[model samples]
Target: MGIGQGSATCGSRTTCGSLDVKLRLFSSIRKYYLFSKDTAQVAFFVRYMSSQGPKEELLGLLPLSGQTRGEDIANAVQKCLEDNKIDLNKIVSIATDGARSMTGKNKGATTILQSKINHEILTFHCIIHQEALCAQTFPAEIVEVMNLVIKIVNRILSKALYHR
Candidate 1:
């Protein structure tokens, strides 16, 4: 069946139907290694099928100050889920950018989260990241053109007036 058109509300007690509710969590972490300091951040998003239809929402964007390990990412995801009152049992899968911290067999965030839950959950690398990885193999001429386009876009976006 085609997905119905409507936005789902996610509150302390979301009213989304319980049956066949498949929750998919997508996470991506970005680490910045500067000369003076290091910083890392993670963004969490959730997709689910509600009674009305399918819906998606951003759960949180949190920073990891010290170390961006699997445990730390798992803890941040747990906190975000708990804060949103989302039951871990509802989650059917978790997708990430395929970073070692997220996909490691022993100490990855997905592994740790799966250990916390009673049921099996699917884990996969996000397709967007995979596409980006593939793009890296493009011819140098195409890459140069893409980079030039990006520079032009950045130049336009950097202007305050362009935001309006």
Candidate 2:
């Protein structure tokens, strides 16, 4: 991995490879993906920067036979990390859907991982969920316009001439 000697803006000018610089670089090195659990599986993906820019890889997935509470999810995550020989300290950001079990104030997976890692891990709610919420708020006029457009497109596409 190319470790570019990055700089950090502190109260005073720091030299290259300083603690601040190393911390900043380390934090930006990789992203942790904390996916939601709907069934009985818990999984996470790893997104890292490379010569080709950001690429995501599936770390691992573990099945849970019991309850899917925050504690259970946290344990499964821990096992996945251990099985994959991944260090928790490298996790910079955790991305998950906004479920109570995933984002609960006291016992969510994010909170549990933060506590175990003892780092101020950044948390991000899934953008798809946010977009869905925003979609629900679209004005009636805009929805009607979109419906009309969809109908027109469907009608056109259904025609034999357009099928070609």
Candidate 3:
């Protein structure tokens, strides 16, 4: 659909002043979402600690409902927070892939899900933007290497992607 870009909102408020208390440093990781048109497929997340530490899989989301909306995601996340005993007050920020769905306006999933539930939770975009920045600064040789890798991956996965 022409890569329509939009975010989401929840339109709710968490406990008072809870946001200021949490959302310090963002997760040193990345958030990924897998969705089939009009339905959320999966949400894959990873958090890295330092440069050498093991990575954390925040969630491999298969939402309870086969068809999930932004609000559904928001509420589910709230449940996860409580179930995992993660105090929202302690969370400083979130790291997402910066995709439109993850950072949209009204229609974006993130905006729809967090409208009021978390007014102050700071959301961060992953370093994908940085990767683009790096490309701009790269030497021709480095660019060639990157392009080659991408071509190889595409060739290797074309069938799989097409089938899907």
Candidate 4:
């Protein structure tokens, strides 16, 4: 998404323009043969203002091996930023799903990342995550109907003519 103007001052040694990064993490279990493996994936999207105007783009998708602790998540993000040659001081804010590993006060990814930066960065829980949590409170009957509708839609979309 296009972010606001890049007026934030850079605290690092470099004088590059400021940027705002949004981070989202997804964890799942995949079955390979008879064994199941836990996998974690992270997606980073950055917004910055260029000469023309505001711009946003996907930085990269990183797959984490083994356990996805607060430290692991933070390191993955740090590596991505470094690989892209983006300075840590340019980060104006970070948005996460509010998971314990991401939001934990002492060792959360955001907390750790903030410490690495010279200036304070804004942190907030994603609204989509909040909506998903609220959806869980929906009545069973309503949820069932929604699921049935999704199935019907999927079946229709699966057909070539219907999809077209």
Candidate 2: Cα lDDT at 11: 25
Candidate 4 lDDT over 34-103, as tens digits, reads 5545677888888899999999888988778787888889899999999989998899999999999998
C-alpha lDDT (0 to 100) for residue 106 of candidate 3 = 70
Per-candidate local distance difference test: 0.83, 0.81, 0.60, 0.82
Residues forming the 10-long window of minimal summed lDDT in candidate 1? 20-29
List, residue by residue over 62-142, the lDDT tens digit for candidate 1. 778689999999998988889889887777999999999999999999999999998999998899999899998999999
The candidate with the higher lDDT, 3 or 4, is: 4
Runs in model 1 lying further than 4 Å from the true structure: 1-39, 141-164
lDDT of 2 by residue, 1-164 (tens): 76454544432355433877888876876566556756688767889898999999887777876787888888888888787787878788888878899899899988998898857888998898998888799999988998899899998888847333
Number of the predicted model whose lDDT against the real structure is largest: 1
RMSD vs true structure, all candidates = 12.2, 15.4, 19.6, 12.9
Give candidate 1's TM-score.
0.62
Off by over 4 Å in 4: 1-38, 140-164
Compose the digit string of candidate 3's lDDT tens values, residues 1-164.
46433332222243333664464323322244545655454464645465788677855574646535555565666666677786545444566666665566775556654554445666777688767766899999988999999999988987564543
